[model samples]
Target: MSPLRPEELQALLHAAVDDLRPAPDGYERIRAGIDRRRRWRVPAYAAGGAVLAALAALAFFAISPRSHTEVVEPASPVTGQLGSGALAPTASRTASPPVIGPALSPSLSSKGGPTGATATGSATPSTPAPAGSPTVTPTRRAENSSPATVAKDGDIDGDGVVDPDISYNGTALVVTLSHNHQTRAVTLAGVVTPLHYTVTDLDDDGRGEILVEVSGAGGVTTYDVVRLQPDGSLRALSKGPLPLVVGASSSSGAGFSCSGGLVQVRSGTSDDGTTYQVTTTSWRLSGVTFAPVGKATTTSYDTTSSAADPFTARCGTL
Candidate 1:
């Protein structure tokens, strides 16, 4: 081996020294990278803290109870219709209209028997009805010595002839007796008028009785029985503006007739070419009162054709 020159030896020494120098500042680069990551972590940590605070605030309000306050409003008025075809305005409950009908009297009785119209010039004689026709039997009442006794063939004054005169005084009916020349006035209450009269032998005693029919409100008719006294006086046998039939409360007109010791009441009602009804009530005299014995009713309707629809019902002895 030859001895190395100084320059070559120095060059080899410099190369070895260059190779031995520390790797280019690796710890400084790692420290710079760590500093950059710390900067980004600060912002992320701040955003995460803000989001947690917002979530806590939302949870706190969601569980709170709400207020319960009532809001009341006033009721308004309303127009309502009643059962009787009337309209009423009210603030609360609607009112019901009054019922339109005749009041039944306690003194009168309803019974059944054969029916016949009173003898009238316009009335046609009908065949004797079968048993159980609309008729009422009278109840016996105690007899009294009244001037006008309710019996057939009664001449209270012992007069053989039965004569009585009737006249109207606007508000009442004036009855004049022939035997004693006595006069009696009968007045009606509330829109009632004396219509006409009929005579019949009610008790079959050969004496004549008078039946007076009067018109009243709502097209209702009333009947009154009067006996002719021998002393020229009149006695009322029954108290009645009685209804015509069992089911009829009102009527446009009424007719009465006495035959075979029975009195019959007939009433008829008609609508405007649409419907019609007819009813008959039979009554018998007992003492001073006439009792209903039988009743019959018939109803008819008009269809689109010429034929009429009819319905009929009978009750009591009829």
Candidate 2:
């Protein structure tokens, strides 16, 4: 027989141990020894495993840059893309380009100096100002240097008959018409009270209206405008009074000269040798009532020949 290997010897010893009885004193001692050894070996093996695991963890941390510490940042809308706030550069970060439509080039300066493009690139053509440059806005000249000239007709009341006493008072033009054995007075007002006026259909309204210059009374000699109503009434339609002026003297003459819608009241002595007192008053007709509007006092002294001229005679109103 050849010499037995270590395996044969170990198998023979295991068979002998297996054949031993459990109640034997030697068996009990051997079992206690095996249990003690197993307890010690288990603790040693567990300690060794713990040390190995610790070493592996240390190696992992050393090898990887971001292994030990984790950094949490705000999540971005795009998947897997880092936000600008997360990886900002040390040098203070700036706002990102706006994600709008196509980017536009910088606008060219409209200053008087040459443009940057002309200096660097080709010269650009410039449009010249047109010859006799058209006026951006044209101004309109005033209608007439003075107010429109109104035509005068003797028939002021539209009756087609001339009345000698009908006239304009600068504020109102009055025409006295005799109809059906009763005298009826008609007056018309105008925007401007002319120095002299003649009756004409100003607005083509068939009815006659008077044009008179409205003037202020005392120190601040300013003129305004007014119109005459068809019923022989005075109406002030402007910011100031009519252009009628009153003389200082007490004895003055007053008379009315009418042409169409235009009427003028002259209250003063003519070229004849006479002194007269003229009291001219204005009133507005409200229904049947005549309301006092304004009053003026004028006196006229005739230094010429003493001939009794009806043209220069004093007149009155009832």
lDDT of each: 0.40, 0.32
TM-score of model 1 relative to the true fold? 0.35
Report each candidate's C-alpha RMSD, comma-separated, in the order given. 30.9, 37.3
Error of 1 at 132 (Å): 41
lDDT of 1 by residue, 1-318 (tens): 989999999999998787676768889989999999999999999999999999998887676533222221222222222123221122111111001111110110111100111111111112333333322111121122232222222122212222223455676566543334456665632212323444445654434565555444553445456664434345666443242222223223345555667766655676554344546667776555677776565544343447522221111111
Off by over 4 Å in 1: 1-164, 169-172, 180-195, 229-233, 237-254, 267-277, 294-318
Q: Among all windows of ten consecutive residues in candidate 1, which has the lowest summed lDDT?
A: 97-106
Clashes of each: 25, 32
Candidate 2: regions farther than 4 A off: 1-152, 167-174, 178-195, 213-318
